[model samples]
Target: MVNECAPKPHVALLASPGMGHITPLYELAVRLVTQHNFQVTFLVITAGSTVAQDSYLTAYPIPDLHIVDLPPPDMSNELLNNMKTVARLCYIVEQSIRPLRSVLNGLKRPKVKALIIDMFCTGVFEACKDLSIPVYSFFTASAALLTFSLYLPTLDCKADGEYVDLPEPVKVPGCNPIQTQDLMYLVPKSMINEYQQWFMHVSRLPMVTGIFVNSWEDLESVSLKAVKHEPFFANIPTPRVYPIGPLTKQAEPVLTKYEKETIAWLDKQPKDSVLFVALGSGGTLTSEQLTELAWGLELSQQRFVLVVRKPSDCAISGFFSAGSDVDDPIAYLPDGFVERSKGVGLVVSGWAPQVGVLSHPSTGAFLSHCGWNSTVESVKYGVPIIAWPLFAEQGINAALLSNEVGVAMRMPMVGEGGEAVVVRRKKIESVVKAVMEGEEGKKLRRRAKELQASGRETLSRGGSSYETLARVAESWNIET
Candidate 1:
């Protein structure tokens, strides 16, 4: 129990840009406040912030949680536009150091005891170097990815050149072997050295006080075990690893007219009948891929709700343009595709209420980009996946879901040397048909439900995540 006589220990959570990063940190902050009796200040690094980010935060409010947006640095759009996503995220964090330190120094009321940072914002550690407070890393992805990352430094020394060119799959003990193309955080060839150096710097465990991964023991026991117990890591100076999640936001009641209408349509569908296709907030496909997906859905003759984005060659083309003005994605669909599949499908042009849609009874399967947030949400709602991973750690996540967890069937990318990166319409149709009608779909559904139940169990009172967070909370109190 919290010591009622003592003041609540204060903590600060730093979130990087993107809904994938912000959502989990926000949810984790809420849990710390409500369940662990800690006061939390949520610090958002406001570089390239999105409208969806603003709307999501405003939707959920808690009295104990104080939200702060760090001043955006005066970086030109042209400069930011030229850099890739990872480079941009890193640059933003680097620029925020001064303002971040000022925010830390200014918080005097029940002075902050610990600061937890998003994985990308590790550069801000420079700001905290002189402070007495401890800094923790909140890894918002799976433990499997975490294992792979921590093992990268070793892989770097042994491998000759680019990881993408490795002839065989990369192996981490006790985890699924990762294919070369499926590697997380692989940058362009020109930036490989910089990227490797950056990851090597972060992999050294003594840098942070601990790690808070958005995963549970039941979801990733083997990878979690490898992080803690593997002989390979015994020599490394590892930080405390806390698997304290499935920390995803629950669907609030629908307020927007579009959301209400979407939910209403879902309500009318048969149970486990409609396929929900969304490629997260940032994922987009090439026009060719988009056309193939449309025709595939039409051919399957199955019910679907597809959230379409303006097609681009870059998979993450929608990253900075999430809620920005542009042409409707529906206009880009194959000719007569929407009209022909009108009753059987609903094509939302921009964003969809993912949590609400996944929770709906008719959402039997999800065709997702397999972003970690989307992955955890689908698992929480017991929705099997058609794992169509685009970039970042998504490919790793897809491997985990389809290979290790058995909760998803991966969509294969067919091409020579990654030149042709599209899955043809026939393959898309077959996967959709299998997921909706084949025996494999039944198996995936069963596994999804099993993981869903395990997720709930791990978050309940006296459960693994609950106990871990409680212990961490008590430690912060003691440190203060």
Candidate 2:
């Protein structure tokens, strides 16, 4: 048992802007405070924060966790808005280093023992170094993505041209080759160089003391093995990797009207009968694609609960402004689409209680953007997936889930002449059917349940993830 008398070792955790980054890091802070003996100061970047992120922080005020919102960066909103997502985020972190240093200096009582930063906030390494504090990275994505990031620096030195125009698929050791078009986020040609530079800088794996990946061993054994024990990595200066994850939220209290209505709808449906469709906080479909998706779901004739956002020209349009807008997302659908699908489907605008919906008995399959958080949550609930990835490492995640993990059916990228073009309604309808009622769906569901059981075992006492986190916590104690 942990000593109740000693002053807790203080750890400062820095989280980036989006919900995807904020949620996992916040969960980690909760675990550090509640499970292990630690006092955490949770720091978050203020620029580009969304309503969802704000509401999440306001709702859960933990006892031992202190949330510190750093002042916004020096860059103007107009200039920041003009840059691409990766560029904007990198700029935000780069400019906040001085303020971050100030925040570190001001903390009194038990001084911070270690600082854990988000993957995007690696630029703070110098600030922490100046303050004589050790830094670790809280990587919120998969171990597979980490593997690719670790190997990318070598590719940067060796490759002659931009990755978008490569003649063949990009190959990472011990994993399947990926097409160039599916390279994380698709940057416009004008901004490609900026995106590439940001990735190259962050991909330097040896910069941190260690990495805490949000994945467990059973779900990503091959990639995790390649990262830790592969002989090819021996020559590289890699840090210790810990797969202490499948980290998820505690059961949230049902308080909002939207939450109540969503759960009530799920309760009315028959067991294992409904499909839950939600893109991540930032995943958006184009206007044409949104209409097609609506038609497709209507054609599939499956019971579905879809969380819709207003369509935009860019696939990641909701990244900065997901929940802030007041417009009805249903306005973007095909004419009378809501009326036609009223009895068969329910469409929610903006956000829904994802965990509650996923855990509902009526939820049979998830139509997801394959964000890491959504992917792990589906595994936790034993819900099979129709993987329709949109942006930012989601394609890699979709492939991992479908080809390697056996928990999802891959939705083929279909358009008239190019992969970047829209996916027609027929293809969407077909994949939806395959995951909802077909033979392949059964296999996916069975595998999903098995993985769910495995994940439960890992998070339980004396399990793999449980033991891994305990060991890390013990090391922190020794350091303090």
Candidate 3:
């Protein structure tokens, strides 16, 4: 195709089985191919019976971006349910090495320059090393989480015992203070036993030539400085860190048949008036919590679109498949909730057209689960958040967004024993009103807008994110 002129550098991007990981990688690939002129091949690990991959490809098909699927691990349903997700994913990736090696050996033209892998897929690091291919770790989390991962090695979790029971706020060198409850509430006990395995993975981080994060400098300058300058990290000989992010989805993402109806409904709402609610893929609430959320939105007197998930479904079971046209979510809702707020709210069960809703002219605020992707999207659109964290790194993000970033208001959650507690309807109404109308809401809005402008600026030509990718491109040249 190039007439033996300028050969395109081929780079492989490896994504594990989750929307949280794949979405950012998808954004990064788009920029790399269209903006930087690299040929990207995605080596995707097959997920269990989820529709995430199929939906993403169907919704946003970049034919220029080649894909090769690695075989799914033959995990037994019973064992798979009990095993920690990270452990299972990492183990599955290890099993796929034979096939991956065969594929790599069969390569002809456009040789792979580097393998950029999700942090969870650390098995590929060694394979790349043996094959003389450049390898990079991609952190899909916030800079704060990445910093924590680097610092985790230094802290003695074994001596301290369980994550939540730690006496004081766990402090990472040069980074923000993290409370035990906020930081470790969702960490599985299996992670403690697997610390040796985790260390084996992260210890390999510095061995790579570079580490790519889905974040930008302006967004987390303080945390970033800690990551780069902290004396604790100095002992490790860390990789060249690249904060080449804000790679969140653009507003108005490609539409699916499911989204068409949602978009049409949104079209009728007034400008800067509707509140969009959806917890990111892994978030779910108990039946009681749902009732409060419904009452809260109704009492706020705000126009809204809520993406409700089926309570019986597996957590982390979403990528592109949320709700299709076949399911009606109304059955599970609170009694008379829909009839009481007919025109005022549109409640749909399943996945929502998130970016489309975020980018709409009528969208005023986002009530999010505080997942990094949702956080980035809200930040990208200048929409203030009602930070409602349920699990994983969401608590860290909620702390960052509400306390550090000033772009959101944190919800007061009282969950315990893996059961969702009822957040009072009054608390919900207050937070909703605060973002939808009050002066405090206005302030949050202004800050979010400021972040939005900076986020976009960094992606523009000659901007920081743009230049950061330049370094990544240059790294590709070293091997080619």
Candidate 4:
């Protein structure tokens, strides 16, 4: 193994205050501080920041890991309801960058080498530019997704309305022709016109020295190659793009007492017999969708564990309920679904021990929303997946897992005008059954094992990801 600890470097990771963003950043922080002897300060804000605090509290502690909190914005409305509100929050954060910059400047540590910021937190890059602090953009999504985002300028020209003929499968510079479906979540057609301008502006930012993606080379070789050959990215001489994943593998399981019990239950089950189902922390299911999912799980006749936040109006009584706030749409899961499947299933409310459950020997398959983190974690464990992609890049991740990776089966997506659509129960059951028992399922399982083996090999001594991390660390130049 490379000696990441030999030359200790001080680093800071700035995350967009969300679970999806913070979790990977936390894992990276852990790896840098523990494995590479780098001192890291994790910058966070009030909203959605508690998740990171809780996670770090439960995990290994590093004396150098500092949490710098920015004051909350004075707003009553949810940012999800309005993009403008999100932009305003970003503006406020941008204003707060000076204090952060001052703190970084004051860090007495001589080896403070680099600043890693979330892709969305462009303010950090702008703030630290004059200091010569090499700002690396950490993309939490797939390499294919990044490539697709880069090509949005081209896709925009060809687009007519809601759909566009997928640009020909020409070889992209750093990637292969990622299937159109895999790129579907790149930018929603509704937001493309506006986002295209944003992408264009951000792509030219000077502080973005390198792009660090949380993916492995073997998994995204075509896309990685495309990124290398792209013209727009050619001039950023200091910021090289690197793929260092699957990051989930580096995370140690830090389950709570409740999570430990869940793992114990999973252990009692037959090897590869249990299916784990979870939507990410932020995803919400409509009442109708919830019922269908419940019915579908029942029909699959598989031993399963479903994690939900709340029960819907149609939900049957006597099931475990997390009692989330009524107004929170996610709190509306169907009741009694857990009781009906009692002996055959377990329904965990609130947060789940996702990594621990997935790594369990009894876990045969994952019924996931196809979030990139979940996708990589499932692949890491060699768990066959029933892909039920929801919003964002989830659908794209599902497509790659099912069609490209050959290790997962995709559930049919229903709905026409985006928001009005939902995946039905019948289709969910069908896909689950196919993934759990059919010949295709067997093939996917075999492929999953092969991928899992490859992941292990890549993380071993002299592996591509390992070498990439070492190279990036050595090449880093601290502006202090």
Cα lDDT tens digits, model 2, 1-480, are 857787888889988788888888899898899888788999878778888788887787888799888877677888987887777877776776658888988875487888888788877777888888888888898888888888877777777666656778888887677767666354433477576655655575588888999898889988898878777665676788888888876566676666688888899999888999999888888888888889999999999998888887777788887566566866898889889887788888878889899988999999999999999999999999998888878888988899889999877773433356667889888888988889999999999999999999988889998888888888877884
Residue 128, candidate 2: Cα error in Å is 1.4
The 10 consecutive residues of candidate 2 with the worst lDDT sum are 181-190
* Candidate 4 local lDDT, 247-363, one digit each (tens): 873444655655666777887889888889887655556667877888888888988887765543322121111223223323454566656787788867655778888888989
- Sum up the clashes in candidate 4: 21
Instruction: Estimate the TM-score of every prediction.
Output: 0.95, 0.95, 0.92, 0.83
- Candidate 2 positional error at 91, Å: 1.4
Model 3, 1-480: lDDT tens digits are 345586678888887777788778878888888887887887777654246445674465675587777766566767655655556655656666546766775665577888888876777755676778878888888998888778776664443576666677878788778877676545554466455556667666777778888888878887889878887777777787899878876554545665787888889999878999998875666767777888899989999998887654334444334333246667667889878877888887677878888988889899988899889988988899998886667888888888888999877775564234568999999999988999998999999999999999998988998998987787676564
Top candidate by lDDT: 1
Residue pairs in clash, model 2:
none
Q: Ranking under lDDT, best-scoring first?
A: 1, 2, 3, 4
Give each prediction's root-mean-square deviation over alpha carbons.
1.9, 2.0, 2.9, 5.1
Q: List the residue pairs that clash in candidate 3.
A: 322-350, 322-351, 323-350, 323-351
Candidate 1 per-residue C-alpha lDDT over 202-246 given as tens digits, one digit per residue, 9 for 90 to 100: 675458989999999878888999888887765676687999889
Best-to-worst order by TM-score is 1, 2, 3, 4
Residue ranges of candidate 2 with Cα displaced over 4 Å: 1-3, 184-190, 414-418
Judged by lDDT against the true structure, how good is candidate 4?
0.67
lDDT of 4 at 111: 44
